[model samples]
Target: MSSKKGGKSKFLSEDLNELLNESQFLKDSVSNKKITKRQKNDVTEEESLAKLIGQYQANSKKKKLDVNVEACKESRQKILDVMNNQLETRKEKSNNLLKNLSEVMVQLEVDCNAMKDNEKKLEHLTGAVVKCMQQATTAHRQKLKVLKDIHASFKKQCEEMEMDHKTETDKLAEELEDDIKKLQEKLISETKRSGWENLRRTIFHAMQNDF
Candidate 1:
């Protein structure tokens, strides 16, 4: 930003300089034009004055001649005074314009410096913001990692619990199967004893009937 302001100041300076040059050129042109016109007027007036003096001298040899010589001198002096006044006014106006331009240039320079300072401050603020964002991102990543670790641990625990439950269920199933087998063997033995007792009773009753 400072660089950009510097470039802008440079551009403004060039434009101001160009304006100054153009103003100087215009002033010079006006001066030259007025001087040339005054010189032409002076030449014409001198010729008229010479012709009038020749007429007066020729008429004086015959009689008294009345000539407003003082009036002519006064007119010339007034013309000179007016021209000088105009020149001085023009010079003063040009000086004023130059002064105004100089003030504007100085103000622009001051504004450019102020802008450079503000830009530097903005740069610092931007850096701080970027740093804060980076810190927040780092913290977020750390939290995400922690959550992942906790999830992994929880999953591992769940898997271990499921395995233990399966092991206990299998043990219970085996014990139930052993109990069922023992009950079945006891039922078969009771049936054989009852059938044998019935057979012995029948043999004894047949022997008594034959006697």
Candidate 2:
């Protein structure tokens, strides 16, 4: 009975050692699983951070493109406005030049008409002067002809008067010479008669004394 009790106690000690070894193995497996799960969670967090960074970069690039497009549109509108203003100014200047040209053309036409009228007047005046000169020359020729006729008539009258004067002088000279010859003959006859009468008277006186 003493040997059998000692063998049973030894058998019980071996069984208790086996249970302790099994419990240690289970604790080691639980620790290894916990470490693997913690590693997986860390990898998932790094992937989520990478996705957020990519989204932020894409949004920034889009905003910059939008700003550049808006600036380009504003610049194009300003250029168009300036070009339109320049075109309007040039159009106004062209209209003013056309108006001035029209005014100049009107004045030139008026001046040309005036010159034509003056030329016609000058031609008329020249014709009138020529006509007057011709009339004056005709009148002067007629006057000269009349003067020459008067001078010839006066010369003929003077010649006739000189001939009548010469004839009257010759008639007076002949009548005076005949009257002087008759007076001389009458004086001679009277003297002879007176001498004969004186002698007869003397003889009569002598005879009366003798008786």
Candidates in order have lDDT scores of 0.53, 0.50
Model 1 residue runs over 4 Å out of place are 1-125, 197-211
State the lDDT of candidate 2 residue by residue for 64-96, as single tens digits.
545655565565556556655765665566557
User: Where is model 2 more than 4 Å wrong at Cα?
Assistant: 1-35, 126-211
Candidate 1 lDDT: 0.53
Lowest-scoring 10 consecutive residues by lDDT in candidate 1?
Answer: 61-70
Clashing pairs in 1: none
The lDDT leader among the candidates is 1
- In model 1, state the lDDT of residue 86: 60
Candidate 1: tens digits of C-alpha lDDT, residues 1-211: 5697567556656755665576456546655768765666545754765575556545552332123333444555665566557656655665575566556555655655565556555555778765665565556556555655655565566567556655755565566456545544544443333333333343234223422
